[model samples]
Target: MKFKISTGACFIFFSGLYSNLLLPAMELQAQNINIPIVSQHNALVLQVDGNKNLSTIYFGKKLLDQAEYNNIPELYKQGTDYTGILNAAYTPSGSRNLLEPAITVTHADGNNSLDLRYVSHTITQVNDDVSLFSVVLKDPVYNFLVTLYYKSYFREDVLEQWSVIENKEKGAVILQKFASANLYLKAGSYWLNQYHGDWAKEMQPEESRLTHGIKTLDSKLGTRTNLFQPSVFMISLDKPASEDEGTVLYGALEYSGNFRTDLELDYQNNLKIISGINNYSSAYTLKPNEVFTTPAFLYTLSFTGKGNASRKLHQWARNYQLLAGKGNRLTLLNNWESTYFDFNENKLAALLKDTKKLGVDMFLLDDGWFANKYPRNDDHAGLGDWQENKQKLPNGIASLVKEANNNGVKFGIWLEPEMVNPKSELYEKHPDWVIKQPGREEYYFRNQLVLDVSNPQVQEFIYGTIDGLLTKNPDLAYIKWDCNAVIYNAYSAHLKNQSHFYIEYMRGLYKVLESIRAKYPKVPMMLCSGGGGRVDYAALQYFTEFWPSDNTDPLERIFIQWEYSYFYPAITSSNHVTDWGKQSLKFRTDVAMMGKLGFDIVVSRLSDHDLQFCKEAIKTYNAIKPKIWQGDQYRLSDPRAGSIASVLYVNEDQSSAVIFNYLVNNRYNEGSKMPVLLKGLDPVKKYTIKEVNLYPGTVSTIDALKVYSGDFLMKAGFNPDVNAERPSVVLEVNEVH
Candidate 1:
């Protein structure tokens, strides 16, 4: 029997939608909501319960039977319907639904949720290859309107989801909990793979078997800290997952602030996943006519394996989502590790002289350039005061920028506009602009305080300050925006509504970035938060490459870059080489060439031989960037937990290829020679391979091996002796016509 929720509750017999299936419980009349599932060639599919509360069904593969919906009531009773078309039970919310309370509000003077029922849905064409679906639901008792958005596009077998919550009630309603997207998958033995690490050591790929409960990863320290990240993968691991053969479901929240990613399994073995912004310390209060929009949650499923899943993300990032906008071939040098907080007009001129010799594209002038009331010789002072320090750079920024441009290198400067120092003039003027709990001891990180971007005044200050600097220096071609502190007590003295801190803060930050981007549309900038802290899709809208990690230890970087490549293309990563008294320059040069090549070593200090070598390396990076940044990257060997690590990049047409190989333990590890099987190539084509070993200590050379067909090379593999001193080699291969 079907029932309808009229002003006067009544029941009606209906046998149209559910195939005339009989049910024991009083069921709601199935609305004529025809949710269309677009699955071509059985690559991927989506099924929605438009008949009820817009619930999601199998979305990955055509693995379920249609008859399963005939007896939803039986499934509901057996605890299998954690994703019940409209689950309102405690058991469902507790263990099955990833979000604790999909809907929470204080409407009747306390925490209560009125029954939310289905309303309607719509599909709109976005472009030639993309479409959007919006499902509307309403809670009559509380009068809340919830709209769920799902966007599907061609290629990569991907979809994006988010939610919008509006207060349709007469009075204000406190939204205690909300989630962007949730998914339910049939029972299976699944394994979870995720990215985790610390500051300057981000993107450590890890995998572990999923037990029979909730597995969660979150960032509560605000600013999407490196601890618990926003990127993760849940793949069906009947056996071990490989590069090209397994069911892998990858997901990431396009948010830069506090976020949560969870994978939960119910007792019935059904799996549920929820990902969105973290509503940890505050619940947004929505006034009448007010609405809250969550950041986009991107996900994709691949049956061919985890590699294809990663390649899909990489393709999207480079083709559509990159902040660079397109085809940017920029090589640069950053004066941070070499000079730190010390520099002058003369010092910078010398660096620019060296920059031009190497054919470098840009010269990035890092921190300590701006300080009006306080000396920013160290990290403790001069953050908010954006004026140039006359004592350090006697020539104003415009003058310095002109000098760099005269030398053929575009000049860029660093700014921490969203932060303030207690010893700076800006903080002295408006201490209230910083975020701090009233009467609290007030915590500080990196001797700096985070600005309360939620406050309109602070937002304007950040925008105006950076705007002034760029306007003063039109020759400036780049900006390195660095955020060095985690948010705490994100309180705004100007706003009485404390719950809106996260949302408002991010909004303000975006407003400032967007304003700058509008003014300087052609300049390329990097997003850095003490290194690799704010590298997400949300921030990618405004910034170009992101500094992956501060620990440019090339050995450690090999693992870090590999993990990051799973979701992002090399174009969005800026890598640098350091002559850190320990590692050989050759080893570091080869590592830096793997991504956006940057230099941190003092130029004038380098020996004549070392400088010439660097010049040659930069030339190589310049020639190969277009392919490396836009090509299909394949992990030739595991960087972590393996004896040999390698990466391969092949152009879309398979006309060119670049490969890098690193030996884990040349002298001590089990393998004396590393054998690597190249992948993602035209197997029938013959190829000419050339070797360039940066490390002079390496004994084995690429010239020792003979070129063969891609098929033979992939099958027979190539072996390189693990030189006792340096064990890294870089190879360039071209298709031989």
Candidate 2:
């Protein structure tokens, strides 16, 4: 149940649900919080004014209550006066492990109460003047997430302080308090920032231009309103300003983490806040009130070594070694379009022959080998039934696997393990197997039921089913795991009021990956949640690569691929081809190189010239695959700003490197010679650069591209008039050794 309480200067909120799975009920207890004067740096002092007796905080039946106030500066740190706070209560309950603490915090005026029921052992520490915070969920897995919130007041005329705290590695630290505002990238290292008003997805303020030195990008004063209601500014670090040495570390203080080459903008009507967890941080803004009422929260976080994150990433990389790793990187060909339901072994083998000629290494059967009924047996009928169709391939999977192996390719199969069809045998046997409300009609999408991953039996069935296939065929090279449709009407048979659709679903997925890795430590697995539908770090840490998008249009990929590169490692992206409508083949190949280059293309139907081009593109990708896959990427232009240029560079040896630049759209006037300034170069080295020109009647590597010291000028322009409006350039260089 949710509740609202108002006091002399605070608004207390009661959220009954706990945030994550890490604490139990037995150890948690009800407690009260007193607004104390927290002084920092000896130069600045902060005090939560106007509140005294706050002893009304309690839970159902109130089993345990502790009100001892002890300032443990060592555990919580007291040297710094300006810092953020993130605290949680842990209680051991029954046999369920640990549960989160639930209690109400009554305000001094007795007009408001803030009930905190769910918490994870996470905190955000903001010190000094820089509005910033960090997330502290210890390695080896911690059992809580800490969140802090307070009502901000402001005059209706001013744009005040309102932002979210962040950490360096985790990307973002936000309290997505409302359901209407959705995160654009969905998940990654995220931080929060509040503009003049609600976030304007596409607003580019003229005052906030890229700077070369340390300078405040934005400083505005506005009244904070929780849904347009008058309140003061609330500014905290999503990512601290100190996080960047210069204004243009890469480009701007982008919300995009290490790999961000693009910026995504959104405009919301509500007072929405987000976070970018970084180092020791804090939020300090004025609260204007001649009279007020309500209570707030202090969120703090602690930092671990950077390896805490890289270690997780490394583990994931090893687990999905088939799409990565040396020698073991399985080159795969998926027949999603070719055999949506029609291809048998002969048809598959025919494609495999062509795939082999083009250096393809794995033959994958997509979406149609199990159901004998045509269009009728699509995602709806054949799902959950792993049996191979007799008429489609009379020899069965073993024979097909053997045939593919003989043709110099490994075999893989795709499955949506999280769903089942009503027509399937599994569903018929246990109608209660799927998640459903006791009486509400369960809606179906793609003619399938959302398998109850929350149920251990369901999880076991999935794990055993896939494990059985792999055990039967030790030669299986890969598995394409997919989850279709968005989650709605969430219900878990094993949980009550436990609408942990996101958390539980992720847990089940991790369990599956863990089991897979434990059993087959070397098999490569690719994650394809309806083509980047479920793209997030939680999943990336388990699978090697994620299918970027089903849309292969190079034009569309420019933005999608650009954004994906912002925070994630390049090797995590999986590019594929489908029968996309009217897109230039050159552009498609160009975009595919941004990720793990492969052909989802149909060579059998393409012209000889197109087919040859594809072969050469593959070879080109192979030649510089190391750089594109491992090199650092920079976003030369912001798509949000109406420019059409995105560039990625590869520098493996530090001696030689290559770049891929795309002119997304010719928005600049005919005479505008857009500047192409290269980044991530050794400013100390006097290197030589050559431009690979593609135009007119011939190709030439003009080695005359001049070099300029990065100390003074950091930009150069390319003459579009010389190469015509439709031009692309590849810069190759060798460092002066």
Which is the leading candidate under lDDT? 1
lDDT of 2 by residue, 1-737 (tens): 11111121111222222232222222233432322212121010111112211111111111121222222223332233221111222111121212111211122232222222332222112212222111112111211122233211111000011112122222212221211001111111223322222211111112232212221222111100111110111121223222111111111111101111112221211111222211111111111211111121212111221212222222223332223432224456677766676676788878878777666677777776774442224566867777778787788788878877888888888888877777777677766767666688877766777777757788888899789888888887788887664444556677543523433444465566667767776677777755554444434434667776666666666666655554345667777655563545665666666667666666688777677666666666676666655655554444544344546464644555566655555544532246555555666655556654232234554545565443212255332222324434455555655
Deviation (Å) of 729 in candidate 2: 4.2
Candidate 2, lDDT over the whole model: 0.43
Best by TM-score: 1
Estimate, for each residue in 436-502, the C-alpha lDDT of model 1 and write its tens digit. 8888877888888898887888888888887787778777788888888888766789788887777
Return the lDDT, model 1, position 276: 70
Clashing pairs in 1: 200-550
RMSD of 1: 7.0
Write down the worst ten-residue block by lDDT for model 2. Answer: 153-162
Question: How high is the lDDT of residue 552 in model 1?
Answer: 88
Worst 10 residues of 1 by lDDT: 2-11
